[model samples]
Target: MSKYILPVSVFGTVAGCAVLLKQYVTGGRCPSKATIHGKTVVITGANTGIGKETAEALAKRGGRIIMGCRDMEKCQAAAKEIRGKTLNSNVDAFHLDLASIKSIREFAERIKQEEKRVDILINNAGVMRCPAWKTEDGFDMQFGVNHLGHFLLTNLLLEKLKESAPSRVINVASLAHIIGKIDFEDLNWEKKKFDTKQAYCQSKLANVLFTRELAKRLQGKLRWLLH
Candidate 1:
C-alpha cells in the first residue's frame, strides 16, 4: 500500500503539470472582459470548431453575430444554439460556400444590402490536408477555400467595412505558414503532383501575406489582425 501511494502521487503530479503546460502553451483564454454590445461580427465557417466557438464568444459579449458556413443546416443549428446560450436573438446564419466564387459574391452582396454596418469580419474557414480536389473555379481546394475565398469576400465587402470605419478584419492563420512556400508559377497546383499538406501550408502562408499587404493598403482606414 505504501509503494502504491508513491506511484499514484507521482502520476497525479505529472498529470497536473501537463495540464498547466497545455494551458500556458494554448494561451488560456481572452483576458479582456470588454463587451461588444452594438458591434456586428461576421465569421466564416461558424458552424463548428473554432468558428462556432468564436461565434458563441462574441455573442456572449453582446455582439450581433452572422455565421457564414458551407453547410446551411449546421450553420442554422449553431446559430440557434449560440442565441439560446447567450440569450442574443441577433445571431443569424447565412449560406457561404467558400469553395465557390459565385456563392461568395452573392453572400457579400446580401450583407451589403441588408446589414447597416460591418464592424468585424473573421475569415476563419479553412480546409486542412484535404484531397487533391478542385474548387468550383478550378483551383486547389485548400488554397481556394482557405485563402482566395476570403480574399474575394473581404474585397467585395470593403466598401461596407470602410463605411463602418474603425472596423477589423481578422485572418486566422496557422504556424504552418513558416514551412509554406508559394509556387507562383503553378498557383493552381496543375503542374506538380499535389501534396495536401503542402497545399494547406501554402494557403496559410497566403493568408499571412495577404493580411500584411492589406494592412499596408488600408493603413489608417481599417485594422487587420492575423492569428
Candidate 2:
C-alpha cells in the first residue's frame, strides 16, 4: 500500500503540472462574463486561427461580428459556422487583402458606409515567415501585411471609431518583438538581403510600437489594447 501511494502521488503531481502548463500556454480562458448585445466587432483574418476564435467568442456574447479576410470563400464559410454555433446571425464576412492597399481601402469604405457603428476593432491579421514577397504597394510582405495594413485600416476607421467613442482597438502582437530591430533605412528590404524571420520580428515590433504611440495620441479620446 505504501509503494502504491507513492506512485499515485507522483502521477497526481504530474497531472496537475501538465494542466497548469496547458493553461499557461493557452493563456487560460477569458474570465469576463460581460455581454455586448448590440455592439459591433470587426476582426481581421477572421477566417481561421485566433481571429476566428475571437469572432466566435464575441458572437457568443451577442456582439455583431464582421469578419475580414483575404479569402472570401473561407471567410464566408467561417462566418456561417460561427453563426450556426453561436446562433448569432450578425456574423458576416467581407473581403480584405492586406497585401493590397486598394483592397484595404475598399473594405474600409464598405464598413464605414454599411455599418452604423464600430464598437471594437481587432487587428489580428498577420503574416509570419515567408519567402521575400512584395505587397501591391511595393513593400515587404511581412511588414506590409502585418503592420502597414492594420495601421491604414485603423486610421481609415478612426472617424467611425471616434463616433463610437469609448470604443476599443485591439492589436495582436507577438513576443518575437523582443528580438526585433527596425531598420528605417531599408524598411521595405529593398537594399538589404531579405530575411523572413527578421522581417516578421520587425513587423511585430512595429505593432507594439504603433499601439503604444496610438494610445498616447488618442490619450483621452479612445482606448487601445495590445496582446
Candidate 3:
C-alpha cells in the first residue's frame, strides 16, 4: 500500500474508535430500570433475532425465562438452546400467536393459573415490512400482533407484575414510530391503500403510546419502563 493510503486508513480507524468511545461514555444506556436476576421474565417471540439473543443474555444473568412464541416446538427449541448457553435452566415454552386474540387470552389464562407473579415482561415481538393483512378479529395484521396483542397481554398480566413489585416492562420501539400516526377509524385499512412501511410504523407508534400510557397509570413502586 502507498504511504498516503496507509495514513488515511489509520486516521479513519482512529476516528471511528474515538466516536464509539464517546458514545459509550456519554450516550449509552445504563441498566437502571429494575434487576432481572432470579426474576421471572416473559418475552414474546423469544425464538429469534434480538428476542432470542436477549433471552440468552438474561438467562446468563440468572433470570427465569418463559419463551412465548407462535409455535410451541420452536419455543421449546429456543428454550433448550438458551438452557445450553446459560446458568438458567428454568426456561420453558408457551404459546402466543399475537394475531389471535383468543390465543392471547388463552395464554394469559394459563399463565394466571400456573404463575402467581411475573417480575419482568418484555414486549419484544414485532412484525415489520409485511403486506397488508387482517387478523381474525379484523384488525390490521401489524397493528393486531405488534400492538393490540401486547396491549391486552400486558393488561392481563398487570396484576401479577404489580404484585411482584419493582417490575420492568420493556417495549421495543423502532425509529419508524416517529413517522407514524394511528388512524383509529382506518385501523383495518378499510378505505386506504396498503403500504407495508406505513403499517409497520403506525404499529410501532402504538407500542410507544401504550408503553407511555401504562407507565403513567402504574408507576410508584409498582412498574417501570425499560425501553
TM-scores for all candidates: the values are 0.92, 0.91, 0.86
Residue 168 shift from truth in candidate 2, angstroms? 0.4
| CA RMSD (A), model 2 | 2.8
lDDT of 2 by residue, 85-130 (tens): 9999999999999999999999999999999999999999999998
The order by descending TM-score is: 1, 2, 3
Give, for candidate 2, the lowest lDDT window spanning 10 residues. Answer: 21-30
Candidate 1 weakest lDDT stretch, 10 residues: 21-30
Model 3's alpha-carbon lDDT is 0.85
Top of the candidates by TM-score = 1
What ranges in model 1 sit over 4 Å off? Answer: 1-21
Candidate 1 residues 1-227, lDDT tens each?
89799899999999999999988866799899999988899999999999999999999999999999999988999999999999999999999999999999999999999999999999999999989999998999999999999999999999999999899999999989999999999988889998888999999999999999999999999999998
- lDDT of each model, Cα atoms only? 0.95, 0.96, 0.85
Model 2 — TM-score against the truth? 0.91
